[model samples]
Target: MTELNLELTKEIELLRLVTVGSVDDGKSTLIGRLLVDTKGAFEDQLLAVRKKKGETKIASAAEIDLAMLTDGLSAEREQGITIDVAYRYFATPKRKFIMADCPGHEQYTRNMVTGASTASAAIILIDARNGVMPQTKRHTHILSLLGMPHLIVAINKMDMVDHDQATFERIRQDITDYCAMQGIKDLICIPMSALNGDMVAVRGENMPWYDGPTLLETFESLPVLGQLDEQAFRFPVQLVNRPQTADLPDYRGFMGTIASGTVKVGDKVMVLPTGKSSTVKEIVMFDGNLDEAFAPQSVTITLTDEIDISRGDMLVRGDSMLEPQKEITANVCWIGDEPLEPRKKYWMKHTTNTLKAMVTDIDFKTDIHSLEHEQSDQLAMNEIGQIQLKLLKPIYADTYANNRATGSFILIDGFTNNTVGAGMII
Candidate 1:
C-alpha cells in the first residue's frame, strides 16, 4: 500500500493521561472541573457535590463543587483527599480521553506509579502556593523514567497565588530545567486553577497574561502514536489453542496481542529462545482471518510448521534484530518494603515469561530532588536504581527505550508473591 493509503487508514487512539502531584495540588479537582465544563458530569452528581458544599473549599455559591465529580469514595469525600486512582472518561470533538486521577500522598506513590505506567502523557499538578515540593520532583522523575512521551506541568490553583505572573514563570523555568536534566524534550507548562475553572476546560478570563493552550486544547491537538506499527513485529504468545476434536484434529493456533509492527500470511517468522523457524499460514480472529495484522491486535495464528511453542514464547520476523539473552542490565524501581540488595532472589517476569533471578549488583540510584545519580548498595521502598541481574533462563528482550511492551519486566517476591519492583532493560 502507498504511504498515503496507510495514513488514511491510520487508527485514532484514546489518550491515556495521569494527573499527579503533592497533597492539595488539585489532581482530582482538575479532572472534576474538566468533566463539569465539558458537560461530562451528570446532573445527579452535580446535585450531590452541591449538597456537600459545607465540606468543600470551592467558594462559588451557586456552582456545584467540581471536586465531588471525582473523590467518589466515602472516605475520600469525608477527608477531602484522594486515596485511589479515580478514572473519568470524556470526549471532545477531536479526541477521546481516559484520565487517571492518581493520589498525591506519599504512601500511595505505588498506586500513582501504576496509573502512569501505560500513559503516553502526564499532567503534573503544582500548587501555586507550594511550588516544586519533593513530591513534585519525585513524580516528574517517575514519569520521565517511565518513558512518558509528554509532560505538562499544570501549575494549578493559581487563584491562591492571586494569579501572579512571577509565580507562574518561576515554576515553569524550574520544571523546564528539571525535565531537561532528565533528557525529556516534550515538556509543556501551563498555568491554571482547577477549583475556579481558569485555563482548564474553558478560558476563564482571569488569566489574560498567560498565552498558551488550555488543557482541553492541549489534549485535542496532541498527535497520536503509530510508531509501534512501524517497528519490528513482536508477538508474545499468551496461550496455545489446540482444540483437538474430531472435526479439527490437526489444528493448532498461537494466541496473543501483537506487541509491535505487522505480519501477514507467508511472512517468515522465528520462535524466540528456541531458534525454530516457520511461515505464517493463517491469521485468525474471533470473526475471521485477516490478510495482515499489526501491533495491539489480538489474534490466533497458525504457522506452516508445528514447532515446539507455548505461552511466554515470543514470535518475531526471522530477520528482526531483537536478541535473546540470560544476563541483562536494567534500571529497576524497588517497590517493596525490603531493599533490593545483592544475593536477593525474586521471580523476574518479562513479557509472558517468568524465571528465577538474583540481584547481582547495584549500579546507582537517582536522587529525585536533585536528579543526581548516587552510588548505593541497596534500594529501599519506592527507590529507583540501576541493577544487574542473573536470570536462570534466557529470554528475548530489548531496551525499554526501543520497545516498551517487550523491554519491561516486574520482580515478584519469592515468599509473598507480590510484585516487588519494575524493571526496564537497559
Candidate 2:
C-alpha cells in the first residue's frame, strides 16, 4: 500500500469488477487467463499448472484450467464449480483492479450478489454455443437491478463456434436487446476464447473480424474509481481506541472506518441519535496525525469537546446529518434453505450498526429473468424481493444505490447466527 502524503494530492484510482455467467461458461478460466497472461501469477503455481496440464483425462492439451487459482477448497476442486465469491488483485501501469469471481450456479446467487454488490463493472459471460440461457437472463437482470454503471458482455467459447462472426454477432445482438429492455445502456461486447487465450488479456489473430480492443485493454481503458461525494461528511464509529495510561490518560476518541465523505480538523460535526455537537480536535492514523481522512480509511478521531459517544453511533457534518428512521423498505435477496417468513425476527447488520429487526410486510417479489415484480407473501431461495423491515431501534442508513457502505446489510438467523439473507436499502 502506498502511503498517503499529507501535502501531496491523492488521485489514485481503484477498480472493482465482478465476473458472472452460468456454470461452465468459463468465468474462472477467464480470470485465470487474465492473471496468468498479465504475469500476476507466482512462478510455482504456473510451473505446477504446466506440469499437471495434460495429466488428467478431463484436461485437454494446451488447456490450462484457470479455476485452480481460486478453487482452493478440496471440495470445490473435486466438484468443479465455484461455491463462493473468491477475490483476486492485479494491477497494470495505468490502474489497479480488484476482481471478484462470482459463482454461476443457480443455488449460489446470494454469493454472486455478495461479490457484485461493491463492483463498479460486471462481466457477464455467454457461451457462444448456448447463446442465451435462463441464468444469463437472471444475471443480466441482477446487474441492472443493482444499478451497476458499466457492463461487459463476454461471448466466450468462440472456438466452439469456429470463431464465426455471424454467431458472435447473433449472440451479441441477443444480449444487447435483452439488456436494452432492462434499461442497461452502458454495455460493451467482446468475443473471446478463455481456454486458448484469444482476445482476453492479449488480442489474438484468430478473430480478425472482431475489431474491438481485448478484454484487458478495455479494462485498462475504463475509468476506474469514482469520487466520494464531497457534499457530505459522514463517519460511523466502529471502536473507541482508549488505552488509559499516563501518555494518553484522558484520551476519549471515536475510531471507525469512514463510511463516506471526508473529515478534517476543526470541522463542526454532529453525533447522531444523541444529537450532540462538537468540533474535530484531531485526526489520527496508525503512524501519526492526519490533516484529513477520507472514505474507506480506518482512523481515530478526537473531538474538541468530549461528548457521550459509543459504537454504532454516526457522525456527520452538521448540515448533512441524516434523520434516523425506525421503519425501512429494502430489497432483499433470500439466500437460505428456508423461505423468508413474515413477522420473523432476524439480526440486521449495517456497517457498524447491528439491530434486531422483524419482517414487517412483503412488498413484492421480482422475477430475475423478466425484471417484473409480483405481490408476494414470502421470499424463497434465490428470490429477490422488496420488503419492509421494522427495527427494534432506529438505525442510520442510506439507500443502497446512493451509498454502498451505509445502504447494504446482512440478515442473520439469531439461533444459528448464520447469514440467511443479503439486503440492499431502498
Candidate 3:
C-alpha cells in the first residue's frame, strides 16, 4: 500500500459518506469503481472477483463485475442484492474516505439509516432510466431528517442511456422540481455511469457534452461539517477515573468524549442534574496531561472539588446554563419490526444516559413519498414521525440542529432488549 493510503496524518481529515437508493441502481458497483480506479483495491481482491465472475457466470467475459468487490457476503453474491450496509475505506493524497454502501431495498431502510447517521455526506444513487423513483425520495427524506450536510445525487447508467445530455437533463429537472418545494439547498446532482466507469473516479471520454469534474473531485471539495470547537462545551461523564497508586494518591478524574466546544485547565464547569459546580483542575490524556481539550476528544478531567458525579452525568460550561429537560417533543424514526404505540414504555438511551420513558402521544407520521403529514396512532418499522415523550430522569439536552451528539437518542424495547426507534430533539 502507498504511504498516502496507509498513513493517517493529523492534517489528513476523514470524510464519511453513505450510498443510498433503489436496488439495482449500482451503489456497490460505484464504490467498487472508486476503489479500483484509485488503486484502493488490492490485486488479490481483483483476482478473487475475476475468479468468482467466471465460476458463477455473473458477468460477461470482458466486463468487470465491480460490484463483487464490495458485496462481500455470500448471500449478497448469490442473490445479487445488498441486504446490509458494506463499508469500504480508501484514501487519496488529499483526504481519507469511509464510504458505506447502504442497501437500497426498502426492507433494509433501517440499515441504511444506521450507516448514514454519522455520514458527512450521502450519495443517493438514481438510475438514469428510472429518473426519480419513490425510493429516491425515501432516502432523501431520511438524509434531510438526519441532518446530513451534503447530498450528492449520482444519476447512474448514463451509458445505458447512450450518454444523452437530454436524458440526463430530464432526470435532473424532475428531481429539481420535486425538491424545490422542500426548500432544501444542500443537494448537488451529478451524471455518472458506475457500471461503465464513466465520471466515477476517471474522466470517461464517452460524454463529450456533459462537462463536470468526476465524482471523486466533488467528494474532495466538501467543507468540513459541525464546527464543534466553536460551540458551547459539553462533556458527558462516562467514567469516574481514579487510578490510585503510590505516585499519585488522590486522583479523581472525569473521563468522557467532549460532545462540543473546548475546555481548559481553569474553566468553571457545572455538572448536570445535580447543579454542582467545579473548576477544571487538569486535563489528562493517554499521552500525558494537557492544558486544554476540545470536542470529540476523549480525555479525563480533574475537578478542583470532589463533586458528586457519576456515569450518565454531564459537565458543561457554567455560563451556557443549559437546562435539564424531562418532557420533550421530538422527531423519531421508528426502526424496529414492532410498531411504536402511544403510552407505551420503552428505555430511552441518550448519550451515556439510559432511563425509562413513555411515548405520551403519536403526533403524526411523515408520508415519505408524498412528503406530507399523515395521522397515525403508532409508528411502524422504518417510519418517521413526531412524538412527545416523558423521561423518568431529565437530561441536559439540545436541539439536534444545534448539537447532534447531545440531542439524539434511541428507544430500547424492555422485553426484547432491541433498539426500536431513533429520536432527535427538535
Candidate 4:
C-alpha cells in the first residue's frame, strides 16, 4: 500500500461493537439490515438470502430474509435463533466496524460474554410491542459489569405498532430508567423497524415526532473509549525467539502484543517474577524496525541486557509499580454445566500465564432480575458471583477496571479441558 493510502486507512478508525437483545428481539434482522443497506453484502450473499425467504419470520414473502446474513449456522437458521457469536466486518467512508452478533437465548449467555468482552459499545434491541423484558435486563446488567462505555437502545418492530410515538416513548422511558440504575453514563435511543429498514441505516417516513440520529449515523459518530497507550505498559511475553544461525547466532527477542502503554527504543523495562531490568535495544516488526510501539501491537523486542525471561513472563516499564500476587479476588461468571466446587483446583489462564488455582471462597451470587447480592455456597450455570482464588504460582496483574487485558482470565476445567468460567480481577 502507498503511504497516503496507509495513512488514510489509519485515519478511518475501527470500532468494535456487539449487538445483544432478548430472544426474537430482531437482533439478527437489525444486523442484516445494516449489512444490506450499507452495501456490505455481496450479490451472491443477497441472492442466497432471497432464496431462503421462506425461513424469515418478520419479513414478508415478497421480501428477502436479512437475518440469514449473520445466522450462518444451519442450526441457527432452522431455529431462527442465534446460538453462537457471529462476527461481520463492514466499512463506510468515515469509519469501519467489526460487529459481533451475540446470542440472546438464556442458555447461550456465555456466548454473549465472549462477544461483549472486547466491545467498546453495544446495541440493545427491544421489541416495540414488548417493553424491557427479563432477558433484556440480564444482558444490560452483564454489559454494565463488563464496563461497556456506550450503549444504543434500538426499539425495533415499530412498524407493528403503526409507528406510534406513544409506544416508542414508553419503551424508551423504561430502557432509560433501567440503564440509569445500571450506572450507564452514555446512551442513545432510536426507534427503528429492522424489517422495513426505517431508522436503521436510513431515516424513513415513520415516527415523525421522534427525531434522533439513525443507527448508522450514531455508530459513525460515537466516541470511542480512551486510547490503550495512555494506560500503564504491560507486555506479556508469549514467545522467545532464538535463531542459532550463523548470520545472527546471538539474536534473542521477546515477542508478544503490548497489553497497554507504549515503548520506545532505549526505554528501561523490567522482567516480571525475576525482577530483572534491561533497556530496549530494538523494536522489530515484519517490515522493519520501529522507533516505538504501543498497546495491541504484535512485535518482537530485543533488550540491551540478557535477562532470564520466557513465556508467561511479562515486561513492564522500569518504574512500574505492578507486582506478582498469589491470591486475588475476582467477579466470576460461571458457564460450566457443573456447579463451582470450592477448594477444587482449576487451571487459571491470565494473559499468557497458566497456573493451577482454586476457589478459596464464594462471596455471593448476583440475582440477575433484581441486581441484588445473595449469599451462596456454589455458582450454577450462567450465574455471576464474586469469589476468592489462590494461585499455585504468583503472576503479575491489575484490576479489571484499570486494564482489562491483564485483569481478565479464564478458568479451564482440568478434567474436560474446557473453559468453564471467566473472571475479572477486583
Best by lDDT: 4
Which residues of candidate 1, in runs, are more than 4 Å off? 1-12, 51-69, 72-81, 129-131, 160-167, 208-211
TM-score of each: 0.88, 0.88, 0.91, 0.91
lDDT of 4: 0.85
Q: Write the per-residue lDDT of candidate 3 for residues 1-426, one digit (tens) a residue.
A: 355544455577788988886548877678777887677777667767774444533332124566676678898889887677878888777778998877777555587778988888889889998899887887777787887878888999998888889998998888777666555577787899887778887778888887877799888888755577889998999999877988778888999999989999999999998898999998987788999889778999999998879999999888887887889989998888899999899999998999999999988999877879999998899888999999898888999888889989999999999999989999
Q: What is the per-residue lDDT of model 1 for residues 241-342, given as tens digits with 9 covering 90 to 100?
A: 999999989899999999989999999999987888999999998888998999888999999997999999999997885676878899887779888898
lDDT of 2: 0.82
lDDT of each: 0.82, 0.82, 0.83, 0.85
The lDDT of model 3 is: 0.83
Q: What clash count goes with each model? A: 0, 0, 0, 0
Error of 4 at 236 (Å): 0.6
For every candidate, C-alpha RMSD to the true structure in Å: 5.0, 4.2, 2.9, 3.5
Clashing residue pairs in candidate 2 are none
* Winner of 1 and 4 under lDDT: 4
**Candidate 1: Cα lDDT at 303:** 97
TM-score computed on alpha carbons, candidate 4: 0.91
Clash pairs, model 1 backbone = none
